[model samples]
Target chain A: MHDFFFYLFSALTVLTALLVVLCPNAVNSAVFMIVSFVGTAALFLLLDAFFLAILQVLVYAGAVMVLFLFIIMLLDVERSSRVRPDVVTVVAASVAVLLLAFGMGYLFLTGHDATAATMAAVPQVPGGANPMEYATASRAFGYGLFTKYMLPFQVAGFLLLVAMVGVIVLSKRLTGSNEAGKPSAQEIRESEVSQS
Target chain B: MNHSELLTQLSEQYVSTNQWCALWPEIALALLAVLVLLIDLFAGRLRARAVPFAAIAGQVVIFAVLLGKLGTCDPADSGLLFSGMILPTTLSEVMRLFFLLASILVCWLGMLYLRKQDLPRMEFYCLTLIVTAALMLLGQSSNFVMLFVALETVTIGFYILVSYGRNSIFSLEGGLKYLVLGGTSTAILLFGIVLLYGAAGDPSLPVHSGDSLNFLALEQFLAANPNNVLAKVGMVLVLCGVCFKIGAVPFQIWIPDVYQGAPTPVTAFLAVSSKAAGFIVLINLVTGPFGPMASLTVPLLSAITVVTILFGNLTALGQRNVKRVMGLSGIAHAGYLLLGIVALIQGVELAAWAVIFYLFTYLFGSFTVFGVMSHLAGPDDENQEVDHYVNLARRQPFLAGVLAIGLGSLAGIPPLAGFIGKVFLFVVAFQANLYLLLGVAILGVVISIYYYFGWMREAFFQEQTWPEGKEEQLAPIKVCLPHKVAMAALAIITVLLGIYQGGFGGGF
Candidate 1:
């Protein structure tokens, strides 16, 4: 049953992730990305990381997808796919495929014996139950985050704060369109045309 | 046994007041950032002077406190701090001083830079302080979680800083590129961490009980499972992300555009502090958890060094823009530094020292050049192209000399700090028997002279040309006192460090 579920979620994740890149429209791509993230969340559930699964759904599939959709809407890109498969794209794709093959080969060469041995070694509780196993993964996560990971947690907070300031500072316009400030790109192009 | 009891027990075990002192410098920097903001909010008419002055004064205090902390540090209490999150080793202490010095110089340069540019000086200083604190934290982070969080903090601050000149199309374009690339690298790094976690996360080791992300636990895990394919892949991916941060080849497409477009002082900060932070983290990773994997990483680093040095110098040969030249040369310097990393992997004890000493000299040389650039390029005009530097010596002799010294040191001329740093790195490479790498690095240095002197020639050898009716526009450039002071100070540091082979070079 575990193997079946793993294969199912992994297949769905790969399919939707491919769709995200191949979709013609930006909005469609974003929607497909949401689906891919949902597939990822399901995989996380299979790993017994219930909290991370929820986070994958809430933060990535919901919030991050909405943000992507908002940016796509703001830009109002055309459905027309003008992406020509140039030499650079082709080379990059080929290299990526080669790397993936190499990775898979390495995995096969190493085999799953190590993973099986590790699984066999996971300790059981005194009550003859796996209480400290996946059943308590979410609790263990919280415990780890609050204690061992506190410094990084604080640093992550600062990162978000800096990102907020960055968005505001970069997007804010200090000067109006007709001030004695630096010329806009349009104005500069126009002046160059006139000069030519 | 239950959740609340577990939480309580964890808190009792981990939380302590003594450990907080190890974090004093970071806390002080955070407070100083907020204080600068408050001063900006209330200073009203005095906002300009008050903001920068407050920042400089705060930096001085922080520096003193950090120095005191450094002096008082017991060598015996030298392992991981804060539950294995940060490791305040002697190396971190030394690197923190470098970060602080970079901050102090940046604030001074920013003050003079703001005189000509119409920028909100407050936010600039605030971001500088915050980034400095983040960099200081990065130096001590010994865990993957700490490394990622601190790395993101520094990069996010830089995103805004690189595009602070919102009015300029080039600036916004540069920032957009940086954001996209920086975000991609962060994602790659996180994925690598996840993979490593999956490969070695046993939940049995004490550190692993929380999260097997601690460097000590990770090292043990990797040692036990040396042939793990997933762990090797993750290590390579993480190294790639770090390579991007350091502006190495193949991951360095963003450096030139971003460096050229950023405000001059910011360019200096990125060229020095940001790059130094990247190296410090690289040292921590390569020397700490990644040490046992040297057989794999050495060849990888050697390849990166060869390509990075060759690419940085080859492309720089054709660049007209002085900032772009510096950007490419920065990549070349990263290659030279990576040479040290490769040597470290080969078990040369002084390789780490070579990397830090090189960065130390780079800070002075790069800043002196950038300081001169900021002073020359007023808010009204960006003196970007090397052509604009024609007859600079005749017009502004002081600025010209500063640039010459900066470029000369960068080119690794003898009797300069950069040359000393290069010699040490070469010596380490020789010790490691990295003769091929040494040859490539030497060739890179030889190739760098053409362009470094190309700018010097433009500045000192060529005569200024005035268009038929535009001669009036070429009046002698009047540099402000503050600008002069900063330039002179940086130039002095650069030359003095070159001449005096101080205790700084006696490996930490």
Candidate 2:
């Protein structure tokens, strides 16, 4: 029964991904992507990576998608006219499809038959197992993140910060009087060029 | 020895349990970051521009320390550090040292660039160290779990830094593209990891011979299950993600656009340190985790290298903006680095040397080019067009000369560092029987020259400057001693290094 659900959800995820990629409307594609993400969460649960599944739902399907939606809504981008397939995109897509077919063939031909015994090894750390402690699998993730994964986590945060700062500096038009007491970005740029 | 005893035994094999030689420099960098951040926080009350300079000075000292460590450190002393989330191999040590040096230089340039723009300083330098530290961890990671975190850290740093000059719509778009694509790639990599983990019998064991996610364990696993279809599939998927990070052919989509769109200093950082780190991680994976599976992995790598070289060089020819050209040329350089990686897979000692030399040379060449770009970037990044440099030799003679040398080196012209790096790679490729890749590389060099010389020609030979855009607010050119010093140092270093591939040593 679990296997049935697993295959069903996985198939749904994959098919929805195709829709996300191939769909004409960007907004529709985004909405479909959220569905695909949710389906993937279900598939993760079947595989017993339960924490990851909840993360998939909460972070990706919930938070990240919402952020993406915000951008889409905020931008209110006009519906893009139908894009004629570029040679590169078309070629890439075809190659991907071919590779996918080969992957499927190889899997079916060489893969072992799935069984329940094989699936039980990495048991899911049950949700609500200690929900009050950290609110989600994020607690263990945090522990691992700070300890073993501290370096990368910190770097990722900095990268985001830089990007944020960079974007702001790039967009803001300096008022003539803004630099009355401060050095203007223009002055800074000229001096930088002169120095180099 | 059992688990505890095994660690003890492993410790016994090394000089000292406390003496993880490869890890010292990284420890220094991390400590330095904390120190710099703390110092910066208190800097406002103390002095003007203290924090940024302190951060830069800290990085400079750390770079020197890492170099000192690299000079004396031996590869045989390589071992897992901190339970092997990070490892210290000759390859990673070299990579880390080079990364530190590059970060220092980029941060210095970034400071000047941002100062020119009148942006905040303390946060800028502090973030650079944080990002550099993240990259070091990324290069040293042996466990995929750590690997993901480290990679994410680097990605996040790049994402934020890329958009640091946020007022530009282009910079914002670059960051957005990077974020979305980066997240997708990370997800794909995780999926690949999960699949591999599921396939392994003892999932808790490190990946080599054991069932865990360790590089050495994975290497052993790969050996035992050479024909394990699942493992192979997982490997390919994981490789795909790493390739994206390196900005190689198949996943090279966002690179040129991002490079063109990002602030010049950040672009320099992205092209050099980020590209070098990608090579470092690739070296680790190829040498340790998938060492035995070279046969299958090598050809795929070679093909990508070939196409990437051809594609990058050819596309670069059409670019009108200098930054865009730099981006495309950077991609082509990635192709060259990939050739070095392909050479290592041949199991030849000479080939390994070639890879190292090529990486160091590539690093210098990239620095030279970007340093010159940093010199020419007009206020508000207005001097972006290729035509902006028309008759530059008539105006800013020194900047023009440095630009020439930088571009010449990038094009692999003789007597430049790029040429030496290329020759070393060609010899290795010949030995490795990668004739097709060698030819593609050679062809890339030829194509590269056209664009490089084309820019040089415009800069030097053109008698008149192209009229500025009607909307352009041309900032009068003012050359500073510090900028001149950066260009001269880089230009001289590139030439000197090209003369002999030995003395300046670093890179993964």
Candidate 3:
């Protein structure tokens, strides 16, 4: 059953992800991306990383997709084929994709052996009903985070705060009157250059 | 020890003592950032005058703590804090001092530049403090998790600071490029970390293997498994990511545009503090985790050094913009600094000291040029072109003199601090038998002189051409009080350090 579900989700993931790129319209691409994200989340769920699976859905599929859609709408993106795809770009991209696939294949082959060795090496908890028990899973995460990884956790807060400030500051627009009051120093420099 | 045993031991180590005192500076700065935000939001523009002062005052407090810790903490006393995450060694202490001093200078520069630019002022100070705290955190990170988080915090802060001049297209473009490239490099770095984690494997079963993400543990693992192919790949990828941050060759396409477009103060901060942080982390990784693998990294670093030096200096030769020149020159400096890292790998004891000394001199020299640029620039004008500075000495002697000293140091002229720093690095490289790299570095310095002198010549030698009737409109540049003081301070430090070199010697 697990094997069946894994194949199902993987197939769906690849299908939707392909659609996300191949779709001509911006809105259709965005919709396909959500489906792709959901497929990814399902795969995560199968891996027993339940927290990550839920976050993948809640953040990427829900909030982030909405933001993407908003941007697409605000920009009024059209599906015009103004410029033909260049052969050089296409060739370069294909080579890059092939290289990436080769690298990933090598990584996974070596990584699988390492992971097996690691799993065998880890000392299981005493009196374990199941060594991989999901009980206290989030608790385990919190314990490690608060204790050994406290500094990183706090730094993450500062990172988010900076992002917030950046977004607010960048999105702000100056009042029309403020812009019209006088020529800015830059304008003056340009005018001087032109006059000269 | 088993995984549980390791956790228990680390927890006991953390909970036993008040190790939190060692992190007082970072904590205070974090709180100061929050306070600045609150003040900015609540007080609005009414209390604008108080914000920068508060930021400067917080930096002063941090600086005081750094000074107090200097020469006081014995090497043996310096150890891990917050479990195994932080190693606040004396090395970190000195590096933190540099960060603080740089931050304080940035605040002064930002304040003057902000007022002139008429941009939002409060968040500039707040973010600078946050980034400084992050720098402190980065200097002390002994674990990969701490390193990544602290690095991200600094990068995020800079992304905002880079585009702070929101109205400028150049600023926005620079910020976007930095963000996209920085994000990609970060992903590459994380991938490398994951591979290393896999190669190290689980430490819990206690076959005496290293932990997944701890620097010390990784070092032990690398020493034990010298031929681990996966670990080698991981280390290479990690170096690539860091090279992006340091603006080394092959990862340097972003530097020129970003440096020229970022608010001049932000450019200075990025040029000094950001580059310093990258080098510090690189030193930590190369010396700590990859020490035993010097056989692997030495050749890699040598190739990078040669390319970075040749590429930076040669490309800079054709640049018309002053900021672009500084940006490319910074890349060349990174090459020189990398030579020191090679020396470190070759078992030279003074290599790290040489790097620190070089960075210290770089701070004063680069900031001298940046501070003058900040003062001369108006709200919408960068005044960054080489032509903009023609006959600047006739119009503003102080600014011109500061620029000359700054560029002179950068060009590695004798009797300046930069020259001394370069000599020390080259000596260490020579001691390590890196004659080829030393020769390359000397060539880079020579190439750099032509442009540096070009800038000086434009400022002092060229006649100020005011088109026919426009001569009456041109007025002498009026520098603000804070900028004046800051420029003067940097000039004095550069000259005095060049003459004395006492403090640098004693610190080692």
Total clashing residue pairs per candidate? Answer: 0, 55, 0
Give a tens-digit lDDT track for model 1, residues B268-352. 8998998898889889888888888887898888999999999999999999988889999999999999999899889997888
Candidates sorted by DockQ, descending order? 1, 3, 2
Residue pairs with backbone atoms closer than 3 Å in model 1 (clashes):
none
State each model's TM-score restricted to chain B.
0.95, 0.90, 0.95
DockQ metric for all predictions? 0.37, 0.19, 0.31
Docking quality tier of model 3 = acceptable
Q: What are the per-model C-alpha RMSD values against the true structure?
A: 3.5, 6.8, 4.6
Ten-residue segment with the worst summed lDDT in candidate 1 chain B?
Answer: B202-211
**lDDT of candidate 2 over B26-58, digit per residue (tens):** 566656666666775675576346666777777
Which one is best on DockQ?
1
What C-alpha lDDT does candidate 1 achieve relative to the native structure?
A: 0.82
Which is the better candidate, 1 or 3, if ranked by TM-score?
Answer: 1
lDDT of 2 at B205: 30
Off by over 4 Å in 1: A99-118, A124-143, A175-196, B1-3, B68-71, B75-80, B202-210, B378-383, B465-471, B505-508
The candidate with the higher lDDT, 1 or 2, is 1
